[model samples]
Every structure is written in structure tokens, then in C-alpha cells.
Target: MESGLAGWVQTIGYIGIFAVVFAETGLLVGFALPGDSLLITVGILGAAGKLQLFPAITALFIGSFLGNNLGYWLGRWAGPGLQRRVRADHLERTQLFMRRFGALSLLVGPFIPIVRALVPFVCGTLRMPYGRFLPLTLLGSLIWTVGLTLFSYWVGSKIPNLEKYVYLILLVGISAGVVPAAIRFFRRRSARSVEM
Candidate 1:
């Protein structure tokens, strides 16, 4: 718990938690927020008796789920218009990718940063049936909220000096998301170059 982060978490409290989680899942601008770090901090605070676990988890779950849904709806409403302006082939690739890997993407999205926000939007843009999309989003939200929150709480309680290592944890968690995306990007670029 770096004092800066700790102080921010403490100062903002639960509303801050809800807002951040919601924005991270729903809004494009939210990709830059430190959602994983914030969740872990919330967990540590819960362990320290600063915030109650049930309410915190509830807020996080609702925020994350609704946020994803909102993004989906936004995509349904706005994505087609946007897609019309872009290359048709790019749009096809997006839909094709979603068709092939939609479930996996939904299940894994919340763990990633920008991708988390993009997943639902892309799914809706691709017109993935709502039936197929909802369950996976729910499962992902549960894991992202309950799983990570509880894990951090457990670690905070067990570790002697947990504060010192939080920044490292944040970096690792973020990297888990970013590194894969980076690899995919480079691979795609290399493939295109080879084609040329």
C-alpha cells in the first residue's frame, strides 16, 4: 500500500470503488485506470476492517456487470455507424474473431485492461446473441470481483508487510493483460510485413 494509493482509496472509499470498476468495464476512457490495483487495495482495506467485505464485493460485482452490459448496448447503438466509416475487412475480422472466440474473450476480458472494456462493445457490434453473451459476462464479473478481491484480502491478512509489495503486484497483474496484447500486435505486424 503505497501511501499515495492507500490515501486515495481511503479518501474516496466505496463510491470510488464502484465508480472506478464501472468506468473500467463500460467506458473507453477507463482503459487507463488502475482497476486491478484498486480492487486489491479495496480487499486489503477490507481485511484491515476499513470496509466491509460483503458490501464492497456487491458493489464491485454490480458495477462490473452493468458496465459491461452498458458497453454492449452502446456498441449496438453506435458501433454500426462507426464501423461504416472504417474498412469493411477490419469489421469482418472483428466479427469473425468474436464468433470464434467470444466466450473465451468474455470470460477473460475483465482480467485485461483495454480489452476488458472492448470485449462487450465488440460482441454487441458483432451482434452476438444476448443470450450467449450474458452468462459469460456474469461469470467473468464474479471471478474478477470475488476472486481477486478475496485473494488480496487473504494475502493482506497473511503477509507480514503487505504494503511494500502492492505496487509490484499491480504491475504484474497489468502486465498479465498487456504483454499478451503486445505479443499479438507484434505477431500480426510481422505477418503483414512478410505478406508484403
Candidate 2:
């Protein structure tokens, strides 16, 4: 699965990567896409000189920033009707996340998969000022894009023939990205069941 995904990334190149990032961040259906894993693969490839590091990073940032902007607008356009269609618990949790973190959720959301996809839209429905959303979104995009890409690139550069182990690396990245969220969801469900 990892090799196949990496191959797809390589086949798609910069524009494809941009589109994936945009959809993942902007579109509701994009939550299932492999955003983190793709970045790790891209960084590794860039280090291997199969892809250009700077261009890959730029694509990531642009896609994320624009995608988030689109999501916010979509939320505004769709309003509460869209929120009503979402699972009640998911909507509640996202609202809780926004309340708990305030503006910092924008910074943190980029690191979390489902939350990253939903935060901007939630912000829009809640009518968060665009002036405020823009800068935080920009900063979040920059940090996530640069931090992940450069770290993976450095790892790729230091380890000879790192591409051979790219699948393993992606497995770990996927696990790292997903496990905690799964655990949290289950724990919350268990707690709710116990309360009942």
C-alpha cells in the first residue's frame, strides 16, 4: 500500500501534489487522503533528487492555504444546513476544539487529519473574522509545510538508499498520525457509554 501510494505521488508530481493537498484541506471528502504520508514521501524523493525540494514545499503551502480559505468560504456559504448534516458528535467535538484552543486551533489543526479538514469550515460557520483567519492559516500552512518536508528531507539525505525503506517510514508516519486519534475516539465513546 505504501509503495503504491508513493508511486502515485511520483507519477503525479508537483501539480498533483498541490491538488491533493488542496482537496484534503478544502474538501470534506478529502479527509481520507494521505496528506502526511505523501509529504514524507515527497521529502524523501526530494532528498533522493527525484523531486525538487523547494518546489514541493511551495506546492504544499499554497495548496493548504488556499484550500483552507475555500473551506471557510464553503462553510459560510453552506451555513448551519451543512453543519446539521454532519454527525452531531463530530460537530460538537470540532466546536469544543475551537472553544478550547481559540485561535491556536488553526496552528494545531494542520497536524491533525480530520480536525485539519474541519476547522476552517467550522470557523466559517461560526463567523470568525476573515482578517483573523488569514494570518493564522498562513502561519499554520508555513509551519506544517516546512517542518514536515525539511525533517523528512534531512532524514532522506542522511540515510543512504532511504527510498528502499520509504514504505516502512510511511507506515510509521501513518501510525503516528492515526493511532492517537483512534484511541481518543474510542476512549470518549467508552466514557460516554459508561456515563449512560
Candidate 3:
């Protein structure tokens, strides 16, 4: 989970923001591209006068928008093919999430980490229409990017020393992200043990 590219990307300004956001949200190969880190890093850079907040936000917003659309297409084309080859955990989660969220899941899924990587595939498998998926997904990406970016900017302004403790903050952010899933996992484990 060490992000080697994060340092390089942080230095390149808007292009960096677009590339990272695009890959993380749209390409499965990019799930490790540091979505949260991008937000915080940009904010810190902005505070340090290396980047401007509005430009950073705009680039990320567009990147996120385009990436999700591309993901939906990849999902649509590759989804069923992948599903037919797997009858294991992937299939189970695929069915479960699809059953629960339907096509709208594509719109919500990009915000959810591991789930973010799978939504486009699910959308493809379900043959969800592109027109239906585009607007909502874009809206969601804008909100997610701007909100997190602004939050990071705000925190950076107050601290102004994020570069020194960025890793610590990332660790804390990661823990915060994992807590709910961890709680649910533990609860499931406990219930299973009790049943046995």
C-alpha cells in the first residue's frame, strides 16, 4: 500500500490530479493509486503555494467524471465474461451487490473503496445503459472530489506542516475508512462462532 507514484504525482500540478483521480476511480489497475492521498496532498500543496485550489478541484472533477464513464464501458463489455468464468466469491459478491443496489450502484460504488473497483463491472454485467449511469456518476465524483479536496485544503491551512506528518494523517484516514468494514467483519465472525 506504499504509494510510490504519489510523490511524483504531487509535484506535477493539475495533470497529476487528473491522472491519479482518473485511474483510481475508472481503472481497476488503479485501485492503489491513492484516492484519499491525492485529496490531502493537493490540499497541502495548495497551502504551500505550489498549487491553486480551484484548478486542482476542476482537474480532479473532470478526471473523475471521465474515468467513471470509461469504467462503466469496461464493466459492460468485460463483466459477463468475467462472471461466467468465476463461480466463487467474486460471483457471490457480484450478485449480492447487484441485487441490493441495481444500476444505481454504479453511481454510489465509486465512493466505496474495494466496491469502487467492482461497480463498473457489475454495471456492464447488468447491461446498464450509459446514459443512465453518466450524470449521476459525474455528480457524485464532483462532490467527492471537491468536498475531500476542500477538506484537505482546510486542514492544510490550519496545520501548514502536513508534509511532515502526511503519512500519519493517511494512516489515520485509512483506519477511519476501514473501521466500519472491520466492525462488520468482526460482527460476522462473532455470529458465526456463536452459531457453531
Checking candidate 1 for backbone clashes, the offending pairs are 1-163
Tell me, what's the RMSD of every candidate? Answer: 3.6, 2.4, 3.5
Per-residue lDDT over 61-153 for candidate 2, one digit per residue giving the tens place of the 0 to 100 score? 999999999989989899688777666776777788889999999999888777888899998988899999999999998898888889999
Pairs that collide, model 3: 75-124, 76-124
lDDT of 1: 0.78
Greater TM-score among 1 and 3 belongs to: 3
Q: Per-residue lDDT for 73-177 in model 3, tens only?
A: 876778656555444565566568768977666556656665665666566666777777777777778777887788888888888656556778878988997
What candidate 3 gets wrong by more than 4 Å, as runs, is 1-6, 83-107
Candidate 3 weakest lDDT stretch, 10 residues: 1-10
TM-score of each model, paired residue for residue = 0.79, 0.89, 0.81
Can you give the lDDT of residue 65 in candidate 3? 81
Q: Rate the local accuracy (lDDT) of all candidates.
A: 0.78, 0.86, 0.72
lDDT of 1 by residue, 135-178 (tens): 98999899999999999999888875575566777778778867
In candidate 1, position 132 carries an lDDT of: 88
